[model samples]
Target: MSARDVLEHLQRLGMSGYEAKAYVALVGAGRPVNGYEVAKRSGVPRSTVYETLGKLVARGAAYELRGSSDATEYLPLPPEALLDRMRREFDGSVAVLRSALPAVAAAPEGHLIHGLKDAEAMLDRAEDVIAGARRGLVMSVWPEEMRRLREAVVDAAERDVEVSVVSFGEDADPFGGGRPGAVYQHKYSAPEAVLEDLGYRLLVVVGDRREAVVGGFGEGAAWGIYTADPAVALMAAEYVRQDIALQILADRVGAGEIDRLFATDPGLLRLLGRARS
Candidate 1:
């Protein structure tokens, strides 16, 4: 990776810009460097190199050496040593906060929606929600997504959480290709038809009716909205509930009318024809 990329990564791990630059330069230098040399190599201001180097020494990320003519040289702590020290500090801080924070009563969570752009992130969030479900889960997902999260769903069911799944395919394939829970297959409406029209497959997951994640999964532009707003979560869960209801209705009324309904809808027909090809 480039020096810029390394510096950015170090910054993300809690180093300041100058600190990252100085450290990277020191590592690259192999031998100890004076502040002026560090400033030159790191592209840091000459006037501030001493200050940044001092901070790095205090953080145990660099070593200070006394040299001839009263010149002070700075050597980088080995990368492994610096990483280990930082990891210990981070772990300790997290431990202290985790114990202390719960004593304070949490404020009521407001209606908030988070937009997720990565497909893996969306799937991971859904899996976490499923793993945490106590009472129930309702989900509408494609086989591709189901394949990734099936174990979490099955585990939740094993814990006696009521799990309802809607799988979009022609067969009653269990969502996630695992041991089935309460699953309903939507075969009358082609999911590919919807994908063709919308350019994505919509996956909805509501956990314990407390939170929901709704997303559109395309090739590389997947997007999702995660919300804990009670009303919004309920609405999302209701969407799955209604989908299951439609499947029940289809079972009784036969798929002919339902198939025809999708087949004849102008927009659906356009997509359906595309899906067929």
Candidate 2:
């Protein structure tokens, strides 16, 4: 409605203030505007008028023609055509940027993000990391984190990754009855079994990757760290394997199949230093 509003909108279309003013002056004058006349009428400096008109011409919003005495007169491009070109260029740029988003979003390093959407994005990244795992995924997780682990495992399995876990039950399959992943149950013994009901603030170490995710709520507020380094994963993997053995022994001890968890079994003590921390 006002010159400022028109200028603001035109600026967003890639027009500079002087160029927009010169185009408006040429169209409003209803006649070709020589450089000097455009400068005077548009309030642009005389030396800058030609350059301003050049910008307008580049955007298809104005044109220049040779006049008598070698003077150049400027004509406003058709408003409809100019607007249409601006829209087309903007759309082209947007499409290019949109196509680049997925590649640009891949993680290059460890990052911390708060909340659900970001957590889901990280899980998606994990799926990308594990999509090629053929032998299987070896992960140790706490019970409260079962939901996301379930979703990620189902997604990974859907894509043909074998999923396996060291979880809360000894002698019980970790995948439950209808799930697609493997769960080596009774994985945490004695004091560590106390960790099952302790919410989802747990660590997950699978394949060559290790992550410590500590969060509360269902999904709205959660955070995780992911890394794929060998030394760290080896330690976690060994611990989880030992946890599975411990869960079995603890189950036997609780069931009176074995009277003692210690003093009688040298193997259990040997594995204690290796269980989940």
Q: What is the lDDT of residue 82 in candidate 1?
A: 85
TM per candidate comes to 0.60, 0.40
Q: Model 2, 116-147: lDDT tens per residue?
A: 23556555545544553554566665555455
Candidate 2 residue-wise lDDT at 106: 77
Question: Total clashes, candidate 1?
Answer: 1
Best candidate, TM-score: 1
User: Ten consecutive residues with minimal summed lDDT in candidate 1?
Assistant: 170-179
Per-candidate Cα lDDT values, in order, are: 0.84, 0.63
* Model 1's TM-score against the true structure: 0.60
Residue by residue across 45-77, what tens digits does model 1's lDDT show? 998999999999998899999898779999999
Off by over 4 Å in 1: 109-191, 203-209, 217-224, 230-277
* Residue 198 of model 1, lDDT score: 75
